[model samples]
Target: MSTETDPVRLSFRDVCARRLEWHGLARPSAGSRPADVARAMAGVHAQVISGAELGVGLRIAGATRTDVRAALWGDHSLIKTFGPRGTVHLLPSDDLPLWVAALSAVPPPREGFPEDVRMTPEQTEKVLAAIAEALQDGELTIDELNDEVIHRAGSWAGDLVMPAFQGKWARWRQAVHLAGMRGVLCFGPNRGRKITYTHPGRWSPGFEPAETLPALAHVVKSYLRAYGPATPQRFAHWLNAPARWAADLFASLAGDLQQVEVEGIAAWVVAGDTAVPAPVTPSVRLLPYFDTYAYRVGNQPPGLLYPGRARDRVLRGNFQALIVDGVVAGLWHQRRSGGRVDLTVEPLVRLDAAQRDELGVQAERVGEILEAKPRLTIGTVTVGGHA
Candidate 1:
C-alpha cells in the first residue's frame, strides 16, 4: 500500500547518527580527500565537520580537520575546492578522481534555452578565458573577481550590477562549469581573498590517482549502507544528480543496496549492514544557510517538516533551515551588532523553554564556527500557526 511518493521517513536525529557511524566506521584512516570524505561522511557542504567547532552536534561524529587531513594526505593540506555553482566544498585526498569522474563531466547543460536569453558560447569563453588567465597563478577576493569578470566581458557582459550579482548567470555559471571541467576547485576556502577557481595540481600537490568506477560504486554502496532506507530520489538529491541517473547508478551497483518497505513504499536500504540502530533522541538544532540537512535529499519532502510551508521557505534553490527532532522546524537568520549575534528564529511552532535554550546553545556554536565570537540571544517571534 505504500507508494513511492510516501517515503518511510527518517528523523533528522537518525540522519545525524548515521553520519556519525559512517565517519567512524567507513572513513579512511589516512590519505582520503577532505572534501569527498566530508561529503560521504556527513553529506556534502561539510556542515558536520566545518571549521574548529567539531565534537558538537552532528559534526562531532567526524574527526578533527587536522586528524582527517593527516589521515588522508600524510600532511595537513585542506584547500578550497570551489567549483560547480561556484560554491566551496571539501574533498578527500584519495577520492578526488572518483568525484571528478562522477561530477566533472556533468552532461552538457540541458539544452533548449530561449535564444539570446544569456550569453553565447563565444562571449562565455571570452569571460572565462580572462578569469582562468587571471586566476592562473593565485586566487582573488570576491570584490577583485567581480571587477575582473565585469572587465573581461566588457560591453557584451550585460548588466550585472544588480543588488546581488544576479544578471550575471553567463559569467557565474560559465566560470563554475569551466572549473568543474578542470576537476580542481572541488570545494573552496573563504579566507582573505576568497575568490574561487584554481589549478588542483598546483593547489594540491602530490595527490594519488583518483579511484575508478568500481571505487565510486563502493563509495555509493557505503553511502547507502550508512544512509539507507532512503529513496533513489533522496539519494539523487543528496548527490545533486538527476533521479533517473541516480536510479541507473543504483542499478549498476547491484547487490550493494537492498529494497525495503518503508511506510508501505519500496525504498533502498544499505544492504551489507545487518544492524538498524535506534536514532538519537530528537533535539532542536540551528543549521546554517544551505545546511546539508536541508538540501541533502534528492527530492524535497516538505511534509516531514514544514508541510504546506515548504514552498515559502525551501524553494528549488538552497536556503538555511531550522531543525527540530530531525524535522525542519522552521527557518532562522542572524543579526550582528558589536560582539553580540542576535539569533532571530522564525519558527513554524511555539518553542518551549528547553527548545529555546537548545536553540541558544546551537546558535552560540554557529557564531563560534563562523568565528564571530558573538553573545547569543534567542527570542521567538510567532508566525502564522496551523490550526
Candidate 2:
C-alpha cells in the first residue's frame, strides 16, 4: 500500500541524522574550506557580522574569524550580497555566477513595492544599471551610493525613497540589491564603521553571467547536496520565490535528482547524496540570531524532531539559539560589560556535569573570538520565551 506521497521509507530519526551531516553538525569531514561550507549551507546569513563569522567558524574545521574576514574582505573569495528574501548573506565567490543568474530570474514578490516607493520593471532595470557604473573600481557607503544613483539615474530615482531602519532608502537602493542578484556588485571592506559596496566582477575576476536554466540547475544541485529530500515548495520557501517557478525548475531537473521518501512523503535529493550516517555525538552549539541552521527543516530541526517527543519547533523570528547535538535546546545571550563578556544560557533540559563543562569551554571560546573575557551563567528555561 505504498504510494509516492506515502511510501515506507527512512525513519524520521534517520532523516534528522542525515540532515545533520548536510549542515556539518554530525561527524563531518575535516576541512576549513570556506567555499565548500558556503556551498553546503546554500549561503550563510551575514546581517550581523560577528554572528555570520561564528556561524561559519563553528561549521568549518578549525576556522577562525580571521579566516572568515580574509575570505570576505581580504581574499575576496566570499561575496557578501543579498539573497533569498532580500537578506544579506556571505555566498562563496566562485558560486556567484550561478547564484545571481538564477536569483535574478525570480519574479518580484506579488504584493509589489509600497506605493510610496513603487517602481516599474523598466525603472528597476535602469537603477541596477546605474548602480553597476557607480560601484565599478570604487566603493561607496549606502549614503554615497544613494547620491550616486540620483546622479546617474536622474532626480526621479531619488524620489523613490522609503523609510527604512537607518533612513529613507531610495528606489535605486532596492535595485542595488538587484545589481547584486545580477552578479554586478558586492560588499567591500568597511571604511571606518560604515559598510561600502563594489563590483563583484572586479573582486572575483572570473565572474561571468550564465544561462538561467543551467544556473537554476546548479543551484538546485547545490541545495540538495546540503539540504535535500526537499519538496519544490520548500525550495521556493528557501529562496522566497514563486511556487510555480520552483516547481518548474525542479521538474526540469527531475531526471538528475533521485526520488526518496522523507517520513512517507516523497522528496528529491541530488543523485547519490541520500546515504545517511550514524548518529552524531551529543554536543552543544551556541548559535547567534539568524544562523542558517536556525532556519531548520519542516517544523523543527532534524535533531529536535527525531526520537519522537511532544515538542514545538525552535526556530523563531529573532533569538540566539542553544543547539544540543543538532537540536535547538534553548536560547543564549552574550553581552560585553567593561572588559568582561557575560554569557547567559537558558537550557530546555538539565545538563550533566560533562555537558556543563563542555558549555563552559564553548563560552570561553566565544569570548576569545569577541576579544573579551567571558562570564558564564546558566539559568532555568521556561516553556515559552526567555525566562
Candidate 3:
C-alpha cells in the first residue's frame, strides 16, 4: 500500500495509455468471449442495447453483435440489469452476485423526486417484493408485470406518481431499478418488439446476493483495475454515489489501495498494481455512444482526455467518440440503411494519411460487427445525440 506522504507520480499520458491497455483497446483481446469483454469493462452500458453490443464487440477480436446477443439470451453468460449509476448494463452473469450486493448497498439519492412523486420506504419494499413474485415463474412484458405488481401489492402501487416522457409513471415503476439491484429482476428475451423482465434466478440457478463489504471491495478494486489512478470523487461520480461516502469507503480500504499522483492529481489504485507500460503508439477506434471507455474517463483535468474541441463535442454532448492514441480526438456517427452503414467522423484534430487509413479500418471493423457494408466519410456528422 502507498501512503499519502509518499505517493507514486505518473504522467497523464502514461495513465491514459495504461487504461487503454486494460480496456483491451491498445490491443484487442483475440478469441475472447462476450462475457470476457464485459468483465474487463466492469460492465457495458446498455441503455441502448446495440451500443452495448458494439462496445463489447469492439474489444474482442472477431466478435459480432450476434455473438453478444447469443451470450445474453442463449449461452446465459451475460446478464442485462441495473449496474453502476442505476443504468442498464451487460454484466458477466457469474458476477451478478457481487454486482447486486455492491449496487444494493448504495444509498439512493436523498432528493430524487418531490414528496408526492416518491414512494415511501415501506411502499418501495412491498413493490420490490411484488416484482420478485411476478417474475419468479416466467418473463413478463412491462405491462403484464405492472398489472401483476398492482394486483399483488395494492392499488396504491398503481397510482401514477413519477413523470415520464409525456405522462406519469406508476408508483411501482420507480422500484424497477431497486428490484434489479436486489437480485430479483433482470431483462429477458424480447417478446417480439416489446421487452420483458424475468427473475435472475430463472437463468442463474441458485443465485444469491453476496456479502456486501467484500463485494463492495471487489467492485472498487475492479474499477481501479479498469480505470485507476483515479480519485474517490471520480468513483463516486461513476457510481452516482455521494462523494463523502465514496471518500469514507476509500479510507476503509486503505490497506488494499495505493496512493498515486497522475500529473500531480491525487488518486488511488489497487495495491501492487502500479506498473505503467511504455507509451503506446497512436491507434484509432470508433466507439459507440455510452461505450464504457468513452464514459469512464470521469472528469479528468480537461485537456488530458478530452482535448481541444472534444470537451464540448464528445464529453458534454455524450456523442459517439473517435479515439486516437487513447484520447477523444473527434465525434463519430453511423446511419444504417438496409444492409449499409454510412459512417461520418468529425475529427477535432487534423488526421494524417496513416491515421485516416486506420480510421477506415476501424470503420470496417464496426461494419463487420454489425454485419453491414460500411462507407467511411471523414467530415461533419450532422446527426444529433442519442438518448
Candidate 4:
C-alpha cells in the first residue's frame, strides 16, 4: 500500500516508456497473445472496423484481420460495445460481466444532457426494455431496432432527433446506444452497409446485471494496470462518471494501488506494479482513431506531446496519431477504396534513416491488416503543425 504523502518518484520518460510496454508495443511477439494485448491495453477503439483491426494488429507481431474478426464474430472471445465514454470498443468478451457491473454502479449522467434532449426516467427504462426485447434472439439494424422501439415503447420514443456522427439519429436506437452505455446492448456484425445491434445476453449467455463494488474495483484495477500512473479525474473521465465518485472509489482501493510521482504530477499504479519499467524500445506506430495508446493515455500528455494547436487538430474527430518512439510525433489518416488503402503520415519532426525505416514497417503492418494495396505517403516532417 502507498500513502498519498510519500509517492514513489520517477521521471516523465519512465512513465512514457512504461505506457508503451503497458500498451503491448514493447512485446517482440504479441500475435501469440492477442487476448493479453486487449486485456492490458484495456480495449480496442472500434468506431471504424479497419482502425480497430489495425489498433489490435499493430501490437501483435503477425496478427491478421481475420484473427481479430474471429475473436469478435467467430470464436466469440471479444465483443464490440459502447465502452468507456459511450464509444465503440472491442473488449475481451469474458470481461463484459465486470464491465456491466461497474457501469451499473455509477449514477446515471442525465444531468449533463440538455433539458430538451434528456429522456425522462420512465422513458429511459422503456427504452432499455424495448432494446433488449427487440434484440432478444435476433440482431437488427439501428433503423429496424428503432422501429421496434417505437412499436413497443410508444410514438414518443421516435420524437427525439439526437445528434450523431452517422448522421442525426431521429430515432430511439440513439437511446438504445445510451442503453449500450448502460451495458445492456452491444454491436452486432454489420449487415451490408448497415450496422446491427444485439444484447450481450445472446452472445454471453452468462451475462447477468449484478451491482457489486468488487466488479467496479476490478474495472478500475484493470484500467490502472494498463493506463495507470493515472489520476482519479482521468479515471472518471475515462468512465464518463463523476470525479468525486471516482475519488471515493480510489480512496476505497488504496490497498490495491500505490501512489507515484511523474515529474511532480501525482498518479497511481497497481500496488503490485509500482516498479519503474526499463527504457522504451525505439518503436514506431501508425495508431488509428481512438487507439487506446493514443486516446486513453490520460489527459495531461497530449498538451505535452501535441502542445497548443496540435491537440485540437490531431485529436479532434477521431484522427489517428503517428508515434515515433514513445510520444506523438505527428498525425496520420487513411482512406480505403475498393481493395486499396492510401495512408498519409504527417510527422512533426525530421526522421532519421532508421526512424523512417521503422515507420515503413509500421505502415506495412497497417496495410497487412487492411488486406489492401497500401500506398503510404510520408509528407514533409514538422512538429505540432497539425495540432
Question: lDDT scores for all predictions?
Answer: 0.51, 0.73, 0.86, 0.75
Ranking by lDDT: 3, 4, 2, 1
Model 4 misses residue 66 by how many Å?
1.5
RMSD of 1: 7.0
> Would you give me the overall lDDT of model 1?
0.51
Instruction: Give RMSD to native, each candidate.
Output: 7.0, 3.7, 1.6, 3.2
**Which of the numbered candidates is closest to the native, going by highest lDDT?**
3
Q: Model 2 — which ten-residue stretch has the worst lDDT?
A: 304-313
Q: Please, what are the lDDT tens digits per residue for candidate 1 over residues 1-387?
A: 123343345444444455434543212234444443455543344433332123222254233435544432354244335422324444454455555555543344454344554566676677666666556566566556657666766755544422235444433444554554345333334455353445455555664335456645755664565456577678666655576876777787676666655444566766544344554433666655444342344323555445456446643334445666555667765666776666667676677888887777667666664545645544443333211
TM-score computed on alpha carbons, candidate 4: 0.89
**Candidate 4, run of 10 with poorest lDDT:** 378-387
Cα displacement (Å) at residue 187, model 1: 6.6
Candidate 3 accuracy as TM-score: 0.96
- By TM-score, the candidates rank as 3, 4, 2, 1
For this target, which candidate reaches the highest TM-score against the unseen true structure? 3
Query: At residue 276, what lDDT does model 3 achieve?
Result: 81
lDDT of 3 by residue, 1-387 (tens): 458687788887778778778788877789789998888878888999999888888888888899999999998999999888878989999999999999988878876888887888898889999999999999999999999999999999999987899998898898898898889899999999999999999998899999999999988998888778788898998888999999889998978999988877788899988888775555888988887343454435556778788888777787899988878899999999999999999999998988888888899999999999999888987878875
Shift of residue 209 alpha carbon in model 1, Å: 6.1
Off by over 4 Å in 3: 292-303
